[model samples]
Target: MIGSLGLKLARFAVVLSVFALWEVLSRTGMVNPRLLPSASDTIAMLGQLLQRASVRSDLAVTASEVAVAFVLAVPCGALIGFAIAENRYFAEVAKPLLFFAFSIPKSIFLPMFILVFGVGFSQKVGFAFFSTIFIVIMSTTVAVDSVKTEYLTVARSYGATTAQTAFRVYLPSMLPVLLETVRISMIFNLTGVLLAEMYASRDGIGHQIATWGENFQMEQLLAGVLMIAIIAMTFNELVRWVETRCSHWRT
Candidate 1:
């Protein structure tokens, strides 16, 4: 544990070193201060936003949207994936359709979603769901396909029922990989929600950032950007921790 903590600290030190270099360069005019504010200035801006009630409210709304999208996505994606896995015919029938949907650019759907779901939370959820579904579906399908036939044969040899093979062999086999896919899809959904909010929102972190940018309030803009990076980083770290725990069985 001590050794693990040391490695984590060392990694953080490297990150801080890079930020320190950027701060020095920006402060000394080696880099354009206007274009690249020092880390200290960005941190001060972040502090200001954290103190404000409005930013907190905006963050809560955005978080709620993200959570909702994720909740809706996981079960649906898993079901589609599981269906395809259970039968080769269904896989062939569905794979092309799913691919076509994924291939279409997400931005193109914004107008349609707005038309259907309107400029509200429904639209945001739709955008987030659209952005992430394909990743989870495709990943889950691949994981299912990769399950060895030998395992199925062994189960059958032992007189395992179809349901038993699916539950004991197939489901357990896919859980870790499916979870990894979900983590990646979550990241994709987060980006989708933020971009959707930026496009059309009365209250969200993305909306606040856009508002600040429009007013050329560099400090506030920087603050919002910093907050986003922090949030994204937090998600990444949590996913990585879960991935590490889940994948230990693989080796």
Candidate 2:
């Protein structure tokens, strides 16, 4: 508990130090206010942005794209992961192909997505789904392979069927890894959605940020960034808490 508290305090201190430096830089004109707004101004503008209906709509657009992409990726990723993990020869062939594809940055395909889907939410969801699915598949396959053979043997001795053994033994053991993959994919999913919006979109959080930047609305731009940070931090904590809860049965 004390260690956790100390870590929290350290994180808080770092954030405060950064904001303090930002405030000083803006106030002293060391940083151009036109390009980098004061921390206070950004905070104030963030509150205003939250209160605006148009901004709320943009947030909703981004949120919906993320939700659709995440929903599509999870089951598909798990299926792919299980398939590869269950077959060594197939895994040897497919794993390299999957990794090779994953190594290519999602940006490389943004133009293709835009060309295929045009500048709208479909492209955003598609981009996010493709970008995030690989993480889930890679993590799940590794986790499945790492499951203890002893656990499966014990289940078999107890008369557990193959399905029961997998669900009751293997999956429980791999839960932490699966949740960690979700946490990681959540971040990348958002990045893909935002990149889509920034590249071309009629509306969304990313489009709003880009609009602010183009307009030289530095304070609003920073505020938009802060909003993204808040969203990411919220989901990160939520996933981490669930991961911690699931881990309690492990050790």
Candidate 3:
């Protein structure tokens, strides 16, 4: 209890120090106030932006893009991961290919996505899926592959079929890692969607931020950025809470 309190206090101090330093820098002209608005100005703008229905609508659009990307990625990733994990020959052949593909910056595909999808929400979803799907697939494969041989052997000794062993043994063992994968995937999903929006989109929070930036509306831009950070952090915290709840049942 004491340690947790101390940690929380330390985090608070760090945040406070950062804001204080930011304000001082802005006031002292060490940093360009036009580009890096003080914390107070940013917070005020954030408050005003939050009250706007249009901002809420943009927020919803970004959220939907992330949701769609996650839904598309998870099952496909799990299937691919399962296939690679279950077969040693396939794993040896496909793992390197997948890793190489992941190494390729997914943003490079954004232009093609925009060309194909035409600067719409579909392009954003596609970009996000392209960016995040590989991580999910790789994490899922690693998690399933790491399951103990003894556990599978025991299941087999009890006459468990492949499907039974996979669902009853492997799935349970991989749950924690799967949840972690989900958390990570959401973060990337948000980032990718935002990048897509910023790159070339007519709507969404990222577009708003881009518009604000182009106009030199530093407070508005920072507010949009902060809102995104808040949304991502909120999602991460929720996933972490779920993880904590399932911790006892994971292994």
Off by over 4 Å in 2: 1-3, 249-251
Instruction: List the RMSD of every prediction in angstroms.
Output: 2.8, 1.5, 2.0
Tens-place lDDT per residue, model 1, 52-167, is 99999999999999999989987788788878867889988999998888888887788888889988788889999989888888888888986789999999999999889989
Give the TM-scores of the predictions, in the order they appear.
0.89, 0.96, 0.93
**Candidate 2 TM-score, true structure as reference:** 0.96
Scored against the true structure, residue 246 in model 2 reaches a CA lDDT of: 95
Could you tell which candidate, 2 or 3, scores higher by lDDT?
A: 2
Local distance difference test, each candidate: 0.86, 0.92, 0.89
Cand. 3 TM to true fold: 0.93
Model 1 per-residue lDDT at 130 = 85
The weakest ten consecutive residues by lDDT in model 2 span 31-40
lDDT of 2: 0.92
Q: Write the per-residue lDDT of candidate 2 for residues 216-242, one digit (tens) a residue.
A: 888899999999999999999999999
Best by lDDT: 2
Between which residue pairs do clashes occur in model 1?
Answer: none
Off by over 4 Å in 3: 28-30, 161-163, 248-251
Residues 103-135 of candidate 3 have per-residue lDDT tens digits of 998888889998898988889988898889899
Clashing pairs in 2: none
Error of 3 at 146 (Å): 1.7
